[model samples]
Target chain A: MQGTTRTPSQPTTAYQPTDRTVPTRSPDRASYDKELVHSILDEGYVCHLGFVRDGAPVVLPTLYARVGDRLYVHGSTGSRPLRMTGAADPGLPVCLTVTHVDALVLARSAFHHSINYRSVVVHGSAYDVTDPQEKRTALDALVDHVVPGRSGDSRPADKKELAATAVIRLDLDEVSAKLRTGGVNDEPEDLALPHWAGLLPLRKGYEAPIADPGLAPGTGLPGYLSAL
Target chain B: MQGTTRTPSQPTTAYQPTDRTVPTRSPDRASYDKELVHSILDEGYVCHLGFVRDGAPVVLPTLYARVGDRLYVHGSTGSRPLRMTGAADPGLPVCLTVTHVDALVLARSAFHHSINYRSVVVHGSAYDVTDPQEKRTALDALVDHVVPGRSGDSRPADKKELAATAVIRLDLDEVSAKLRTGGVNDEPEDLALPHWAGLLPLRKGYEAPIADPGLAPGTGLPGYLSAL
Candidate 1:
């Protein structure tokens, strides 16, 4: 979206799509705008992490948080994938993708059936966050990512818990956001068909919060939970 | 979960986990239960399909449906990934995963912050459905998967439309369902912290469907939309 005249040392608002980030399908829907990619990533709570395992592809759904240009994901200390990511100096090549389905497009022609979705795909090598401070920040960002202000209200990770968790960081460079929006686009002839063609919107919403049964007698729902 | 005493030719209620389906982390949460796997797949509207391209794993989010033991996904015939899936004779090795986040598990310690989620992972090869009748059935199943009774209400696909779309069917052989439910599992010492630790449930619900502005005057809202 912008000129590549800026050196790698300088910070830029736009992402430069590489060969891997470029989409061969619906190319028109792909964008390298950093804001768009960040918005999609922020709206999503979980990401599908794809990596080559024993010559076969494996995808796992896990919680993720985007802080600045870096994406952070944490796992158990005993997790093989996380351990493998930090085993090598260059780290593990990974594809992290987050998607949000806005609506279901019911076109007149069945072939045109599609979903209104916003997705961000990041291609990079994931490195383990060995620094304790960075690890704590990443973990806090992850909790705050799910619900704003909740991190401040929640207790910070202790030494024992921090020692048990492993955090991996992926700096977003080859990033692209693909989005399909609006109503259905039916064929000229199919427009006159009797079938109803439009969008059936989908939304993920927060419901009433349930407090732990072991809560102190006087403890009440936090203000942030009420707002959510 | 049931014993796998039935023959391959006969239907079985339980799924047998191989080396691939077993989880390296949180192995206790993983199950080889067919009913649980099906339930997780059925509840999700989108799935992340991972495949290898240029020796790198790429994950794409797309619509999918589960019928019997077969999972069906369709895309544009011109799509590069979809095209490569059918270009090979034996089909393409894929890891299809569906996840549903039931609640946000907030623990007193940030490291224990996790999600109550149900996810199903199916590892197998996907083959293109060539038969016209089978393709139609698969397409219908995909449509109904989004909204029950939708395929019956909507017009079926025509010959030309079917020709333009490529349907890939993946048989569910190596399937595993992983789920984390209930409240936060915080450390006993951390329970005394001032932070509020509980669950924030998330729900996906349908709003009142809006009719197309270009709809015929007498055309009314579908009954299915009302139920939704």
Candidate 2:
């Protein structure tokens, strides 16, 4: 339970949901129900992590794993954001998002073209997971997040590598998942235009697994992987 | 030539080859050459556009298209970043990136779990393309970028709809493309561990086209659509 307590002195920020200008699509698209949020986070293996450094925004595409409601991201301790967050003062406040574009909505008129997509954005004050036990658990959550049953099967991190790594966690409290899934919505006047307009759906699926050339002969591909 | 001849008052950012990052991988794993860059851009239909708004960084997923070394991102004239760039002062300085996750690398050690990906990041000042002719051309590129030959087949934008939309162009100067491909790389010591380690090669391929229920009876899936 010691690892579960928050440090009282850590500064926190209030997140006001973004204002929605389009009356039809409210700013509430800026937030989502927890169920909707966790589904999006769990389904995707990678996320685009965004943070502002030195007044300029840097977006790093990285792997992320979600455990219950908390998301864990890890990298070499030498990485900029990881190093910055691990330092004493102001921890990095990040907006981590995962998205999957489902289809291309080819509207009749050029101006109305849009894509059907599912995206979730999380807002939180992120600090490095400092406690050794918590760091080990977070790293395990990350490993199992990507390959579900593999964590217990693999050797856990040793002391030296553990010291050289950094892990940060963002709770999925303030989150928003927005989705647009439909065919083209063309303006009335443009319906007669001779353009071919319809959807070109996009999908991602796993093919047959390619075993590593270096893999040992006896170790075959596991069921969880084949299921993915 | 009317659109290409008249350059806007804003100066084009020079392409400084040295400003880019040489990825710490095999040379074939990274690219900045025009053909490689354009190929990646053309294949990706969406991008993660990041910028600092107020103080914190925001990354929004949006649709994009590429023409030569320039990328066109379209939005309603009222969108925040689009409006910010269209204002009179210096346009919004933005980082635009597109990525494709090709495979998942499952290594023996937990630390080496990674993904094989191809991504392009363009760092430049983004401005609203105000010229009517150029805006139209950019829109065309955006359309054809997603669906080949669809631009010519579709009706061009009309006067009023053009006014309600904005196209922000980010030149490919100061751009970096990084990729990770190949099987998992496990540490030599972990080879004896009794765990499975290999790549689950991820791929995106079109399924049988789901004809739009609203399509006219005579209209079937186009040859290009089926071919993909």
Candidate 3:
């Protein structure tokens, strides 16, 4: 429920096309539907954050959260990207991407082998969040993003902890989702070959909740986690 | 068996640490071990590749394979990154990263919540691979990387298929693996809190393979896939 609020100024269904969001190849696989982009972004646990450092590109994997039309990424105040955004006057340009591999498509020919995946890419300028209220909301969204309703269950961050953390915000203006689904596309001539061709679906989910050893004796498992 | 050969010039046990490979925040979590890096890279199906374009960073998810201390990424010849690398005189500077989320670490306090994960980041220049022999080997490695021993079972690429694919190579000279493992690390004072804190382990693996409907009747599932 954190990222469900919409403003009148925002696009109703699909995002507007931008130069960077358009793919140079396989344009058919790209989509600007707002629902598709949000679903892909929400399903991911971490995002690969790209930024320029010393004139060279650097990519790092970190936690992220989406709220309405904005995305939030956090780290220690001393982290490189956070520090860079704080020092820059306007903002730090960044590319944030999230991907989910659903299955492996094995074809009769090596050339046709591919993976079925869903991915979302957002290009924008990241600015450090200084407002105390927005920062707190972002932090709660980040925690809840990992596990729904987790923020209310856990102890909120104290003043000292809040000061040590840095949160950056990126508006989801230039965004697009690319996806590939379904079966293998082997050549017709190679259909009768000895190779066994098919789809190997990748399964991912939570196993069981492991309780902390130091947990209080009477603590019970939360309903939100049990439902997952 | 592909990508296992090592040259005499390569390091024995670990990779050399470069300035860009070091993490500015959690230095203790960074590693340069060669085996650790290879194991992490081999387990992933997709990588987030980052490159600078027009002074801004771009990140895309793509399939990749590792040969010895080198990584190969393939795409259509008309792809933006592939075209850019072919045009750049000294090759294109890129950051390739792979990550696996092992578990969700839930702490009694929101500040200590984190994920247990293993990730590898490689910083270097990516050059177009024009040599036919090397490109073929890289393509095989790419297939086998998805499923072990799969390259031999599939039909080899023909001349037309090879002409359509573009391959690029990046040496793993500047590489580092960062990992976060073990249980939650909540504040000692919060140990007595009522919240249930622990790790929610994520399970990922291949399910039963679904055969292609057009497959020859007698074709059986390969032993390598059965083993998985």
B202 Cα displacement, candidate 1 (Å): 0.7
Model 1 agreement with the true structure over B1-228: per-residue lDDT tens digits: 112122232146778878989788777778777777889999888999999888888999999998899999998898766898889898898999998888898777777788888899899998989998888889999998887777876657777778888999999998888888778787777777777778899877866565556654466667776777
Clash tally, candidates in order: 0, 0, 1
* DockQ, model 2, C-alpha based: 0.43
Q: Name the best candidate (by TM-score).
A: 3
Please report how far candidate 2 places residue B17 from its true position, in Å: 4.8
lDDT of 2 by residue, A1-228 (tens): 111122222123322334321112324343345665677778787788888766767677778888777888898887777877887466688878789887887766667677777788776667899999989989888888777887876777888889878899888766667677666777767666555568777767777777766767688778788777
Give the DockQ ranking, best first: 3, 1, 2
Flag clash pairs in model 1: none
Q: What class would a CAPRI assessor give candidate 1's docking?
A: medium
- lDDT per residue as tens, model 3, B1-228: 112222323466788888889888877778888988999999999999999999999999999999999999999999999999989889999999999999999999999999989999999999999999999999999999999899999999899989999999999999999888888888789999999999999988987899889988799998999999
Tell me the lDDT of model 3 at A106: 94
lDDT of 2 at B150: 72
Rank by lDDT, highest first.
3, 1, 2
lDDT of 1 by residue, A117-172 (tens): 89999988899999988998898899899888878877777777788889999998
> Per-candidate TM vs. native?
0.92, 0.87, 0.95
Candidate 3 has an fnat equal to 0.95
Q: Residue B89's C-alpha lDDT in candidate 3? A: 83
